[model samples]
Target: MNFLVVIPARAASTRLPGKPLLDLGGLPMVVRTARQAARSQARRVLVATDDPTIQQTVQAHHIECMLTRPDHATGTDRLAEVTRRLRLPDGDIVVNVQGDEPLIEPTLIDAVAQLLARHTEAAMATCAAPIADAEALFNPNVVKVVCGAGARALYFSRAPIPWARDALADGRKCLASGLPAWHHIGLYAYRAGFLRQFPGLPAGQLEQFESLEQLRALEQGHTILVHTVKHPPTPGIDTAEDLERVRKILAQAVTAPPG
Candidate 1:
């Protein structure tokens, strides 16, 4: 099945304003992300943004982009606007690639989209990585996912799930041996029809309480298939520190001699 990648890049980030236009190894960050998405199996990649500067930057790189409304509540809403404007077929696959993720793997993009296609019952697909460190598992900012049989997501939360009660009570402050722990990755793949329907779905108590938009789908009785990635994704840009880190990584890549 063919896939269309829609990258939502809003300029008004609270933490890192004007992020899409920020330079990453000479190219704008959004453009770098688009370039990565272009490397995927997707038939087409489009950058959706409300900022004209971002749109112009993406277009200057000769990549397709569309200016969307600035009032969109979330990135998914922005992608929905793109889907409706493009008149994408209901059966077509649409992947929501975050604009900040310049280091996102193209293969992971393909993996999530293919997972969605293979699971007819699921409305969306996402990737997760096993939590290797105790600090990450306990970090509230690190979203955790619980998956049941056949990789169907049972729940997602900011708190450590299936809590290691025994270890915690003993003040071990470490992950229990033989216990499973997974952290949520922000990437997503969705059916075009569902993408259009997402904004209309009722906000559920779990979603509102947790501030996780994906919970709305689960509350509405839609299945989300969670697949594991062999490696965790390089962190996306969110704050000033994140930007500096990515810039340094890019610089190292540029100077590294190819064997």
Candidate 2:
């Protein structure tokens, strides 16, 4: 179960500027994410950021922080830099815990890393949860994943997949009693070796149209295992409203009487 966890905290965010520094329960957002990662069984947890302020804030709490190049196009690229800089072995596992997920479950982190370990043939592993309703199934914003044979992802899209043909035919708006669909989670676990080579993979045609990074791997013919979970953890924070929601959730947890 030994693995490394890296929280990528870029300074700039279009929706929420200075997001890594936003306050969450008295701690910076990225710091809160690092704390969650630390609670996991990871052998090592570090914050990979592009801001010195973020670096100093994380280090102040005794968390390991590495300042990476800000120009990397995607979070995956940032993770690749960490792997190369640390010289992690090919077999080592690296979990990319998004910096905005302060409430992310530690168990989920272990699960994803273990998923990759169990599926040696897979270059990457990610989580997904069942789509319970047609509303969720059809929401373009809710990325859907279809699982293929051997627990690998057949495809991922913002559009609803599997068609649910007979059940949703005739413009029906409700999901069938037992429709099979999955909501893709952003979390990912990669073999350090694969991460080093990921950035060089050509941009995928589907990836360009959908703007989903995972598609790049699928398009490149790399195997990505889909680890289905009963329920997804609280999503990452993206806007002022999301920040307040998490703050309130944390506040309630603090004030609630012990069970």
Q: State the C-alpha lDDT per candidate.
A: 0.92, 0.92
Q: Write the per-residue lDDT of candidate 2 for residues 77-149, one digit (tens) a residue.
A: 9999999999999989999999999999999999999989998889999999998888998899999999988
Off by over 4 Å in 2: none
Worst 10 residues of 2 by lDDT: 172-181
**For model 1, the run of ten residues with the poorest summed lDDT:** 170-179
lDDT of 2: 0.92
TM-scores across all candidates? 0.97, 0.97
Regions of model 1 farther than 4 Å from truth: 170-172
Query: After superposition on all CA atoms, how large is the RMSD of candidate 2?
Result: 1.0
Cα lDDT of model 1 by residue, 195-258, tens digit: 9999999999999999999999999999999989767889999999999999999999989999
What are the root-mean-square deviations of the candidates from the true structure over C-alphas? 1.1, 1.0
Error of 1 at 61 (Å): 0.9
